[model samples]
Target chain A: MKAACVENGLVLVRELPDPEPGKGQALVRTHSCGLCASDAHFISGGQNVIDLSRKMGGPYAALHYERAFVPGHEFVGEVLDYGPDSRRSVKTGRRVTSVPIMRQGGTHAVVGFSHECPGGCGELMLLDEDFLLEIPEGLPDDHAAMIEPLAVGLEHARRGRPEKGDAALVLGCGAIGLGVIAGLAMMGVGPIVAADFYADRRDLALKAGAHIAIDPRETDPYGPLPDFGGRRVNLIYENVGVPGMLQRIVEAAPFDGRIVMGGYCMEQEALFVFAAQNKRLNIQFAGGEEPQDMDLALRSIADGRLDVTPWLGGRVGLGGVADAIANLSGPGTPVRTVVDPRLL
Target chain B: MKAACVENGLVLVRELPDPEPGKGQALVRTHSCGLCASDAHFISGGQNVIDLSRKMGGPYAALHYERAFVPGHEFVGEVLDYGPDSRRSVKTGRRVTSVPIMRQGGTHAVVGFSHECPGGCGELMLLDEDFLLEIPEGLPDDHAAMIEPLAVGLEHARRGRPEKGDAALVLGCGAIGLGVIAGLAMMGVGPIVAADFYADRRDLALKAGAHIAIDPRETDPYGPLPDFGGRRVNLIYENVGVPGMLQRIVEAAPFDGRIVMGGYCMEQEALFVFAAQNKRLNIQFAGGEEPQDMDLALRSIADGRLDVTPWLGGRVGLGGVADAIANLSGPGTPVRTVVDPRLL
Candidate 1:
């Protein structure tokens, strides 16, 4: 099978042995996989992440930095075969998406980060049968692949506990931030404000249902909005994973604001506890998408309730993975670069 | 009127002019006031707090460092007189407690920390008539004074959102931590695990209905609890306000744990955003008690549902304020020192 493999800090397209389905696993052929910014971070500082995971005794402690791994968790695939003791809930040849977790004995491994479990960047991969969700008919593969990332925003929105009168402020205009804006808009939360450095990303935010989009350089996103009518921003979604961003949000957020930290900052961050405590802030650190979130996101996209066509950017093949990853690493206009493994 | 004044970082017992109540205010005679740890922190580093308030542009921005102010918010008092335009909700000479916030124009001031509003550390003080709650008959003054601190814990517990089978781990056994333990126990959240360095505080935790009170040095409070039946510590009340405590809790807590930050860490703190995001921890920083919390706390004590007699320790007068504050600043057996302004 052809795959884009991360080896020794470089992504190389090469021929690799096809993955076989294990117990409770189903072999799937990658239909479309989305490029993620986290993949760039992991490729650059894989060793540091592995060391931190080991020190924290987290689920990713088993990840080996030295080993080559394929990284693509946001994917849509078609089932080929099922392993022994499998539920085989979804029929073969049916398109599917999953929560990107493969259950191993007592613990579970994140499908993309683990060497043993190749991800959608490869032509073929193995997924846990229990986590598989059949894609509804008429939904394009690129849109089906987006369910994973969109689920993350939906989960953050659900965890944020948006009330009827909530004024939302979404930081950063990346795919995750756009998803958050979409989620907030879908839930009927009004007066959504979004901020980003790039003009293109800010445009994407507006298309994703943000009421106001600011460049952040010219305008302060945290400033009082005319639409809020003297009400403060009670719900904040943080998708910018930069250093000091958490502290900045803590300092700028109003009293009793709920901050959903959807950003994954790999570096150490400093905060003034007095600032957060004084404002009585609720800082919720959101994790990966859950099964239910994935289901809801796929349904929303399938029913045209969520228009993710604006987020779909350039499509790439296995050979173009390196360039796509590089384009995503720095500031660019592409919200998501889809990879079709079968493309030669 | 005699009062303990915080002037230029020194607490001095001084004779000040008798306060005259203005519109919507009531003149209250001090009955009992509790020496709080926050009061000590404010006295030691008031200038820094004031500077931070100014920078944050918070409600406390009006606090001035140069002006001498009375530092006691946790107090039980008697309504001596009411000014014009006041509702006079409580009868004259009736014992009462308030939320310790005085409405000034469009803004509000924390009663104890403001120069214009002297708190119960003085022989006489002014309280907002709208914020006062009449003390139930036969309730001791010292116990009534404890309502403010206990209400804080109750608020933390309510914000933490404990469920029927949720396990609570309280990180300290100070007045706030003990109140958390009491709140958790009263709400039937168990098995309540409390940690403290001092044996007396550990005893207080047990008396406050903690199922297990462990010295953190001897036993790891985050370790698997035999009483919890293999369930993780889902609800954690962090009353220990040390610098690295938030990061430590983020690293040690299980996935999907809710941590209520009740401790007021005066200094800046560092945290790893990845660590918190990976665990998906919810860090809720609780502020001072609200009016409903105060009412519920007073009712709990009045009905004998909550026994605060165990929390009361030494009794002090105007002259003893300095010593009581000092004792509270260091490690001691006294959970709360009650101050009676009438004492010579």
Candidate 2:
């Protein structure tokens, strides 16, 4: 199987043996996968992440820094075969997308991040049979691949717990931020304001249902919005993952503001606890996609209720994975750059 | 009126004019006031707090850095008189306690910190008539003075939202942390553990209803507890207001832990947002006492459901206010020092 593998902190295209399906696992032919910002972070700071996780006794302590792994979690594929003792609910050749977790006996590995389980960047991947969700008939493979990130947004929105008449401000307009905007918009949370440095991302934010899009350099995202009659932003979605961004948000958030942190900052950040305490702020650090969130995201996309077509950017093949990951951090980056294993 | 006032960044015992009752205000003769840690913070870094508040556009922007102010908020007093347009619900000479907020027309000031609103550290102070709660019969003046701090703990507990079978870890065993233990015990939350450097404070925590008290130097506060069948501490109350305590708590807290920050860290602090995000932690910055919390605290003391007599420490007069304030940050500090202006 040809794949883009992350080895020695560098991504390289190489031919690797096809992954065999274990018990309760199903083999799938890679259809399409999204190039995620997390993949970029893993490529740059995977060792640091592993070290920190080890220090904290977290789940990532099991990951070895020197091991090569395939990096793609937001993916959709067609089922090919199932291992023994699998549930086999979804028929072979059916398009499906799971939560990207593979259960192997007493332990589990996230399909994309572990060397034992290859991801959709490769020609073949394995998924937990019980966790698979069959893609609906009319849903495009690209959109199905997006369910993971959109599910992330749904989870973030749910964690934010937006109420009636609550104004939401998204701190970034990347794929995760746009998904948060779409989720907030779908949930009828209004007057959503999205901020980004690039004008193109800001435009994409507006297209993705942000009522207001502003370049943060020229405008304050936390300022009183005219759309809500000068109501301050009470709910903030922090998708900007930088060293000082959390502290900046804490200072800028209004009294009693609730913040949902969706961005994964691989570096250390600082916060002034006194300021947060004085404002009586509530901060919820949001995690990955859940089954219900994935279900809602897929249903929202399939029903045409969410127009994610604008979020889809240029497509790449296995060889372009490194460039796609690099492009994510550069100026005028697209909301999502997808990878199709056979594109080359 | 003779009072210990914060003047030019120094505590000076000087003769000052007695505070006059304004509209909807009641003049109260100082009975007893509990010296709080916040008073210590204010004395040392009042200017910095004011500057930060001004930068954040907080309510403290109106405070003047050079002005003399009284530093006491946890107080119980006897009503002397009521001003014009005051509610005057409580009869003259009745013992009372309020939420420490003095309403002046459209503007409001926290009683102890504002120069115009002298607090219970003075010979006489004024409080908003509407905010006063009558100290019940048989409640000692010292016990009544503690209602404010206990109310703070109740508010912190409410913000923590403890559930049945939840393990609670208090980071500091000061008066505020002891109050939290009492609040948790009163609410029937079980298996409370408190940590502090001072053995006396730890003993106070036990008296206030902590099931276990451990010296943080000898034992890890967040480690598995023996009482709850090795359940990890999922709920944390942070009362150690220091620069790096927040980050340390974030790192030590278990996955999906709920942290209620009752400590007011006046200094700028740093946090690793990635660590918090990876653990999916919820951090709630608890503010001061609310009316309902005050009522609960008063009722709990009056009914004998909560015993706070153990918290009352040495009593001081107006002349000793400076030493009492200085002692707060030193070793072997008492849970609380009471200031009785009439004693001298």
For model 1, what share of native contacts is present? 0.78
A224-244 per-residue lDDT for model 1 (tens digits): 787667555778899988778
DockQ of each: 0.61, 0.67
lDDT of 2 by residue, A1-344 (tens): 88888887788888898888878889999999998888887777778678877888755667776777777899999999998887888999899998978776665677888888888888889999888989998888998888889888888888888889899999888878988998898889988999998888888788878999998899888878777798878899998776687878888998899999888888777666778888899999997778998899889889887778877877999889988888885575667889998765
lDDT of 1 by residue, B265-308 (tens): 77778888878888889998988688988988888888888788
Quote the RMSD, in angstroms, for model 2.
2.9
Q: Return the TM-score for each candidate structure.
A: 0.89, 0.91
lDDT of 2 at A210: 92
In model 2, pairs of residues that clash are none
Q: Could you list the chain B TM-scores for each candidate?
A: 0.95, 0.96
